[model samples]
Target: AQSVAQPEDQVNVAEGNPLTVKCTYSVSGNPYLFWYVQYPNRGLQFLLKYITGDNLVKGSYGFEAEFNKSQTSFHLKKPSALVSDSALYFCAVSRNSGGGADGLTFGKGTHLIIQP
Candidate 1:
């Protein structure tokens, strides 16, 4: 089955410091990877995606991710963290257009806490 796992339940980082949220996936054949951010009570917003080409993909809000096929991982990163960056992040994977569903399969999500 195609699935994504986020080993960390939460990530705490000081403001202005670098931040990372880990993600790993299991899928058949090549996979379609995606990252999403969710604020309080709001729906998930699209961050970035790795479909074909480009191992390193940049996304909204100064966020970026690198797709590593060997490790089957895609980790989200930011050069500097901000208080506003504190939110829930999810890593998703799709085997074939939504990974068999109408959409992708999302991880449990990691709560990012940016301490000022």
Candidate 2:
């Protein structure tokens, strides 16, 4: 079984400051990690994914995450925060392609609030 944990229910940051949304996961075999963001009433948008490659992976909107195998963590980071970046962020994990019964298991979600 695979699972993800978002310890923080919300993260508050100033518009110009940097922000980070933490995430940790547990899984059998190699894990496939992903980040997605959702705006009010809109569908979730894919932010980034870590399948295999460099430890640090970059994604949309100047967001990046470091895949720490030893720690079993994938924490999302943004060098500079923006008011528009405020949204519901989710961290997910799966051992496979995330289909059928083997679908991706998502975290409860972290509300990123960027105050301008």
Candidate 3:
């Protein structure tokens, strides 16, 4: 079984400044990591994912994440954040079982507050 951890309950970042939401995971084997964001009154939207190959994975918006196997971290980052970027972010992971991926194990949501 795999699990994800988000150490911060909330992260405050100034608009136009770089933002990072920390995420770490524990699994028995190679893990499939993902990042998702949810706006007020909306469902979680896919942000980025780490399957294989590249260490840096880019996705929707200006968001990107670096997969650090050594540290077991997959922190979401954006070079510059916007006020509209404020949302609840979640980090999830699932085991990649040759056939397909298993159901995701998600961490407690982290509120990313982008101050104007």
TM-score of candidate 3 on Cα atoms, chains taken together: 0.94
Residue runs of model 3 more than 4 Å from their true location after superposition: 95-101
Assess candidate 2 and give its TM-score to the true structure: 0.94
Which ten contiguous residues of candidate 1 have the minimum total lDDT?
94-103
Give the CA lDDT, 0 to 100, for residue 7 in model 3.
99
- Model 2 lDDT at residue 100: 48
**Tens digits of per-residue lDDT for model 2, 29-80:** 8888999999999999999999898999999999999999999999999999
Q: Model 1: runs farther than 4 Å from truth? A: 97-101
Better of 2 and 3 by lDDT: 2
lDDT of 3 by residue, 1-116 (tens): 68899999999999999999999999988888999999889898998889899999999998999999999999999999999999999999986555663678899989999999
